[model samples]
Target: MKFPTVRHCWTAFLLLLASGLSAKEVPPPPDPPRLVNDFVGLLSRTESQALENKLVAYDDSTSTQIAIVIERSLEGDDIFDYSFRLAEAWGIGRKGKDNGILIYIAFEDRQIWIQTGSGAEGFLPDVMAKRIIDNIIVPAFRQQAYFQGLDRATDAIMQLGSGEFEPEGLGKKKISAARVIFFIVLLIVLFILLSRMGGGGGGGYYRGGRYDRGGGWIWWG
Candidate 1:
């Protein structure tokens, strides 16, 4: 019986290895930055009429998510009020080495307004809010795309928000441990397979080449 030629055998083995690897799934990328405007703070900064007007413009007559609440004063160490639980807040609020981005919003003169957190206050000055309305939000609104405008505006804001480094201490260590475990498992599996393929009563490759138990011959140098 003629088994596959040497070159064909090597080619087939490589193909099999490639096919096996292709079955593995790739992990997804991280989520994009989110927009988390503190509603209470926003209202305190702007007039209610103007805030409502802006909402109508942004929401295109559907601004339900934006809530208007009567905020009571909270001390320096007080519970956060009217703060939405945005997914991005995990990476935002009190960012480790990475300073957090806290967008403060409140009613000012009965209008909806926002103030970037102290850390980010310098970058996204309240003064820029006017430009944001003119350049970003207004354009999105004019196109009759409120949600899309929010995304565009927030994305642009986040672009400005980035650049601060955030180091996850214990969290980073945990991730490292996970990678170590994965590598150990992979090594263990590879060694187990190699051992089964050799050091057993079977035909397998060795230091120099395969050992043919039946033939008991060094097939070729």
Candidate 2:
């Protein structure tokens, strides 16, 4: 009987090796959170409403708190500069890079106006982000659910905004989440150690290899 050639044997071996290799798992995209404090520059703009000290509501019809950014153009060499007027027309108006903008929001003519910056990275998409603010942030504010709306807005911001040098959002100032976790673990270890001080006479865990109630040198039962 005729046998397979060397090339055929090589091909068979390669096929077997490929089959043995498990498919590479495509990891889910990073969802790091974005906070306002991360930005190098920060500004807030608020407008006064001629109302008494009563509760004020913010909805699609009334937006109480809003933020806006005015960006400048980056030269051909300095790639950090981001365009003001983008193709999507998501209120990316023109204004030289001299100034950054901040706008306190108020709904008008059934439409929301947003200004994004070349600096902000990983933020909600302009149009969608605007919609989220209108539908979620505003209503939550009206209901006094400030944290809820703020959390949602923050999460969205991290996903769509842009960065200056690093396309990722800015690193937070306070302790990182990992650091906080490590601290908690350390605290637990300390607590356990303190509890197991074993203050003499059947104090520590396991007195007589089983259990002895009398607080003495546990007599073998």
Candidate 3:
């Protein structure tokens, strides 16, 4: 039997090193006991049970899954990537619907990520996700109200997912449109009253001989 060559030994050494690195970097996915996984001990027993019950009821009613995971650290991994991996590994949502949301909080890393599965993206887009974190979760977290933040954020997600109400931004847009329409109508009414007050002579208009209306400019005769 011929001994292994120097190149063969070096190649084997490199392969072993690569395998070890891979094992270290890519840790095994978490096996959560329930929908709420407080690996970091952020939530108390009562809080965890309350959150889990809410999540379970929401899933039962709508068939959409929402999971909350609080970890002490991400082990230097990117929060977004790690959260996505966790969601995939756990299969949080139904198989075909894929309507799942993962709320991941890393205490040491000081990061929060909301990962929505494909089917749930319509209800919870990236912008809305950021809004939930920035507007809802972060504020409560700043006050050290972890459970409150998680509760409110999850409530918002469930409401949006179930179509109980429009997303905040979308709702704001609708309100804005309604305001614009009201303002336009008010302007039209004011213009008509002013025109009547001027008494019959159409030559003297608000601005030259043209009126800038909603759709386009109208030449006033």
Candidate 4:
């Protein structure tokens, strides 16, 4: 068998190297700024400072931690997965609360993901998270106003976390008196159902004393 030419061998080696590189996983970018990490250097010094101050204030007041990260790209990793991992790695929230929130933006991919920890889910659920991205962040991003987008989005998130932010129109709907009354009625009905299920008529006497306490039969020693 004839040996391949040197050029052909070099080309094959290059192809193999490329294949290996493609299969390798790309690690997440470093967190130099800690609070607001712009790995791709997208934000200006002033913009970064402003965002850092906003987040610091938010944390100080509510103890709810929020982090913003902007990367040129995540290579091949899914943003949702990357966000969660980054939050976990950074320990963004308090130890016991797990209330961290991560705002991940991939510029090249044109994708964003809001990752909320267990503690934050109460304040920022899936719907609210998506709304902030779709309405607030995406709009600014489309206009090529990254700083504005990040600033507004962060403010909105902080407000929502503190229960102070409410969007107009759909988000501003107040609970009517009728709805409040209906909710109370529903709770009363649920309580009755649960009581019936739990109270088994006190059929068995534990200690030979049948005690009728407040219209409910109780058997105790």
Provide the lowest-lDDT 10-residue window in model 1: 212-221
After superposition, the stretches of candidate 1 with alpha carbons farther than 4 Å from their true spots are 1-92, 95-112, 162-221
Q: Is candidate 2 or candidate 3 better by TM-score?
A: 3
Could you tell me how far off, in angstroms, the CA of residue 221 lies in candidate 4 after the best superposition? Answer: 73
Error of 1 at 139 (Å): 2.9
Query: Which rank order by lDDT, best down to worst?
Result: 3, 4, 1, 2
Q: Alpha-carbon error at 103 in model 1, in Å?
A: 6.0
Instruction: Estimate candidate 2's alpha-carbon lDDT, on a 0 to 1 scale.
Output: 0.31
- Residue lDDT tens for model 4, 1-221: 11123443454355446555452243454546468888788889988988888888888888887888877876775454455556666677778877778888777877787877777777777677777777777778778788998898888877777688997631767789999999999999999998889876656546642111110111111
- Writing each residue's lDDT as its tens digit, candidate 1 over 1-221 gives 12123543464356446555332221121244222333344223334444444444432332111222322222221112112122123343333222233322222222122323334444454445334544555555456544454445444444444533222220113458889899999999999998888774866556652321110111010
Candidate 4 displacement at residue 196 in angstroms: 35
Which of the predicted structures, 2 or 4, would earn the higher lDDT when compared with the native?
4
Alpha carbon lDDT of each predicted model: 0.36, 0.31, 0.71, 0.69
Q: Could you tell me the C-alpha RMSD of candidate 2 in Å?
A: 24.7
RMSD of 1: 26.1
Error of 1 at 17 (Å): 73
> Model 3, 13-102: lDDT tens per residue?
564465453421333545554799888888999999999999999988988888898888777554554566577767788788878888
Let me know the TM-score candidate 1 reaches against the reference structure: 0.28
When sorted by TM-score, best at the front, the candidate numbers are 3, 4, 1, 2
Instruction: Output the number of the lDDT-best candidate.
Output: 3
Which 10 residues in a row give candidate 4 its minimum summed lDDT? Answer: 212-221
Can you tell me which runs of candidate 4 are displaced by over 4 Å?
A: 1-33, 169-221
